[model samples]
Target: MSICILYYKMFMFYSLCLYFLSLYLLNLDFTLYLELNILTLNSISIEMIVYFDWMSLMFMSFVFFISSLIMNYSEEYMMDDKKLKRFIYLMVMFVFSMMLVIMSPNLISILLGWDGLGLVSYILVIYYQNVKSYNAGMLTALSNRVGDAAILMSIAWMFDMGSWSFLNYIDYFLMNKEMIWVASFIILASFTKSAQIPFSSWLPAAMAAPTPVSSLVHSSTLVTAGVYLLFRFSDLFSENFMSFILYISLLTMFMAGLGANFEFDLKKIIALSTLSQLGMMLVIFSLGDKMLAFFHLLIHALFKALLFMCAGFIIHNIMNCQDIRFMGSLISYLPVTCSCFNISNLALCGLPFLSGFYSKDLIAEILSMQFMNFIIYALFFISVGLTVAYSMRLSYYVLLGDFNMMSLNFLKEEKNQMLKSMMILVFLVIFKGSVLIWLMFPTPYFIVMPFYMKIMTLLMIFAGILLGYEFSQIKFYYQNKSLKFYHYSMFFSNMWNMPILSTLGVSPYFLTLGQLYLTKMDYGWMEYYGSKNLFFLVKFSSQLFQSFSHNHLKIFMGIFFFFFFFLILSFF
Candidate 1:
């Protein structure tokens, strides 16, 4: 165990060095590509290649950096378990797969990494070997397979272009008549991976995985892949497609925010919060600002990872009880963990001067400047407030107020190994936003909006804090009024039953059709005409012939044939 831990730590340090080197190369505007072979058979040609650019290097470096940290955290988190080595190996594989996705320019190669993510995630998710874990893993894997299949189909469609490395064809997609099919599949693929709208359930369910996996996959890498994919292909989408994507993203953001408020579990609240941010990123990408979305993506990764780590520590202290209703005044017990948690939460809410302010605040300002409909304007602003609102509510329930634990317990933040990993990100969570925004955007955005529109950010922040705090105080479980509107309450709490719709609604309908096919086609019409009736008719005819032959039927048939032959000869 010690040797394995040291091995990953060694890798983590190297990735850090590589990150700085990548930044330097980005500054130099260098792109390096390595080609394996270009095979041509007949009129068709296949190119196998890997391309490296500033964005790929940067994204890869971040992924390696976070994953390396997660590997370190899991060392201590999984120390009590017998299979810590297996856990470490899976994390390494997960990181390797993400890197593959990052560096691979060819769509075909990207599928390997994409499928690797889904497979490894399912394994990581079911690491504990429990019923819930198994179910969650299934949901997660199946949901991601949707994206995987889309990517495969996209690869097939791109055969018309004769190049799987479509990075060079960014502008070609929109211009060419034959290439439009590839773009749509890519969009849908990105949607599923990013947990947009219809594909959002798997993400929260995947929280059944260990917290380390959750931090690494949900906070930083896995969920962001969709956003990253679309970011790379931002130029490919038409305005109409962008508009449709934006509306879907808006619904996703709103649904997640609403779900978070009603959620009682500790980790799931953060998961839902992650979902909301993903939606926000989707909006930015669809609006044709990949750089902005990328900026948010990295910053969100830092703080969200920290958020999950802190939650993990808390859950550890509470002996795996994740219900936030049983949690309160944690700051009084675990000050360091509580502080880190709150900072991440505030960052998530886009608190001014914190890490979130630079990117998230910028997103809000940019959205305000856009010539969008009233609904877009409302959802964006309201979603901003909801961000703060959930943060405040989380604070009220978990960090502030009276102790709510049912039993006497001693909780402390002395898990140095885990805390060490978290502290590394604490610095990033505070500074990464400011640093990344500068690095990514050489030129500044020119925002032209009214003073009222400018202050819309502060309005949302303050309103969210106030509303979140007040709402957190309500005895939601005790109030009779809550019972009076179970359906509407459930609609929001269940994120409009997206989980049910995505899981049950989809499967049951298909299953029913499958049953019908089995009863009517497989068991009925095809069986009768194709095999059963044919066999019965052949057997009956054979039996009739045997009976005639045995009972002097041959002599009778010979006599009839001779009579028919004589009649035909006379006619001729």
Candidate 2:
């Protein structure tokens, strides 16, 4: 069989597995109700616990549905890849691990699933085994490991306090005095997984992976795992830490928005945008408002996934390159992809009447209520402007420029299947409600904004687009080396150098120990120290004392002595 056929067959198998898993979960819920009734009627002494709740049920349902669609779409997206079987296997493993993560009853089980997902994602990121791909994979794995360690430490701390089951221990964990450490660790995990602030660099690098992997991991499902963790543990951190979370989230949103505006790579732009959006979602999560957070999560997943898939189509079918500068006038050639791309871009810009508008407005409303400080409000306003800037920049660059026929023809000839898969995702992007519905949860305050405020927000997006167009038209020449160096350095500095510093700072310790061991081997340092005159005299005296104590039989005598000592100690 051809690789494409094999890939489709494997995807079909995963779809079947997901279908059965969803059905089983549904049945499990029904069986729980039946058992509850049986126990009530019989008055039986049954000690049982139920961990599945509304949140878990909702998240799991979404996971299954989205995974099914992505896998189905992958039948086309990954058709021609040589490692098709391995791709399918890793994708299945990723979904299965995510399912387990949502359904886990305890912290240990959740960690197990979390690590499994991270491992499989890393492998998938480096599936091509190119240098850039390997580096991206390594960065993702390292960042994830930092998060995983935090999670494990938090779980251990909780267990040490005598609570193991998450359902039962969550309240206790929250109220404990040591919960500050736990919350910090949880924040670390969330920041790394969601690619917020300092950890944001790895996500852009993750673009080296395939378009499907980039769409699935960076944009849609996997990266959101961190937000899911925070949402799941919202109760534990909300009461005392909500304000701190809000500030941190706002900073992440602002920085990410700025970063996205400056990025030129198509996938990197979306990746940075996703980070910013996730940060916005984190703000919602920090509001102690479950309903708003849940709705935002749903809508963000739908539209962001749509945007990434559209970007993938542009990269694979319209531009034949990752750089947006090389793309132009793709709307005429790839009308369907372009249309979907525009709608998703509009949604991302939080244009009124779209999914992003409702969710983002909800978050803004909650923030306005919680934050009395004007600085934070101003930051929020500026972030709104930045969001407009980046989203419009992305849309204008890819769809509304002069046609580059050579590039367009190359993509059309080479990757028709990718275009087909993107078209399916585009359709979903336009009418996402059919696949997933946003449920509005109750909030303490009314989340309605005035008509004028909505108008102003929409105007900001338009103004951003106009500004981006004007900026794109300006021509500048880089003739001097100093000028080029200054511009490049400023760009990287603004993008943040924390990722670089962390990488370099952490690498030397591992090398230093290895070098020290090699130096000892070369110099015979250990033997030299032991064989010195003072050490030899001490060794001779000790050996003489041991011989006087019948050292030849010391091994057998020592075992017997230990056994007798244990026997006597046991009786005592």
Best by TM-score: 1
Give the Cα lDDT of each candidate: 0.84, 0.69
The C-alpha RMSD of each candidate to the native structure, in angstroms, is: 5.6, 10.6
**lDDT (tens digit, per residue) of candidate 1 on 1-572:** 57456755776776677778778888998888887766876655666677778787777777877877777778777779888778888888888888777777788778888898889999999988999999889889988988998899988887766677887777777678666677788888998888888999888899999999999897667888778778767777788889989999999999899888877888899999999999998888777788888888888888999999999989988989998888888898899889899989989998777888899888888887778999999998898888888889989999987787866797866657888888888988888877887788878888888899999889888999898987687646535654755566667878888888877888898899999999999789898998888999999999988887797767798889999999999998
Best by the lDDT measure: 1
Error of 1 at 7 (Å): 4.4
Whole-model alpha-carbon lDDT for candidate 2: 0.69
TM-score of 1: 0.89
The 10-residue segment of model 2 with minimum total lDDT is 31-40
